[model samples]
Target: MLNNWVDQLNNTRAAAAPFGEANPKMLTAFRGLNAAQGSNGALDAKTRELIAIAVAVTTRCDGCIASHASAARQAGATEAEVSDALGTAIALNAGAAYVYSLRAMEAFGQMGK
Candidate 1:
């Protein structure tokens, strides 16, 4: 395993407690945002969790990955589904890099002029 996700989740929550205490308003707002996502009922929990996992991977957020991975499992997402989501993340990252590479080439050509 890449990480002890369960332990990481526990450790993350422990570490966040003080920060949340210090910024109660921010924490509450964040919680409210999360609640709002579910309130729409447009997507089921499993789909939301899968999307969260993909976003976490794309954003390179370990804490979010751990949290959403567990939630995905709880929401009955299969391993294959998670793998497919990861593949999407990989493609997106590569596509972003490709686009940035084009920008870099453009900047390099501009520098020559």
Candidate 2:
């Protein structure tokens, strides 16, 4: 799909290096949030990563998809589970497009003479 995710993951980390160096506090805060969110809280790692993957898909974020999908695999999500999550994301995205099309139709009706 996109770049090989392993390569992309390395690239993402490398790219973030400059920003992290320039703003250590912000980077620390972000890492803290990531750590806290991904830990064994109410939701386990696999579930959190699956949710993240779904969110990444819905948001159309290539980098997020790469990162979260890799994390999801490492967190023990089976291919079937990932596929199911992606299917849900696909349906939601399509549903959003379908609903938004109705807005366009409404606008056209109002503007037509």
Tell me, by TM-score, which candidate is best: 1
How far residue 106's Cα lies from its native spot in candidate 1, in Å, is 1.0
* Cα lDDT of model 2 by residue, 8-82, tens digit: 778888989999999999999998998787465788889989999999989978789889988999999999999
Q: How close is candidate 2 to the true structure, as a TM-score?
A: 0.84
What's the true lDDT of residue 2 in model 2? Answer: 38
What's the distance in Å from true for residue 5, model 2? 0.9
The weakest ten consecutive residues by lDDT in model 1 span 31-40
lDDT of each: 0.93, 0.90
Runs with alpha carbons beyond 4 Å of true place in candidate 2: 38-40, 111-113
| Candidate 1 C-alpha lDDT tens digits along 1-113 | 77999998899889878989899999989888987887878989999999999999999899999999999999999999999998999999999999999999999999999
Q: What's the lDDT of the predicted structure labeled candidate 1?
A: 0.93
Q: How many Å off is the CA of 87 in candidate 2? A: 0.3
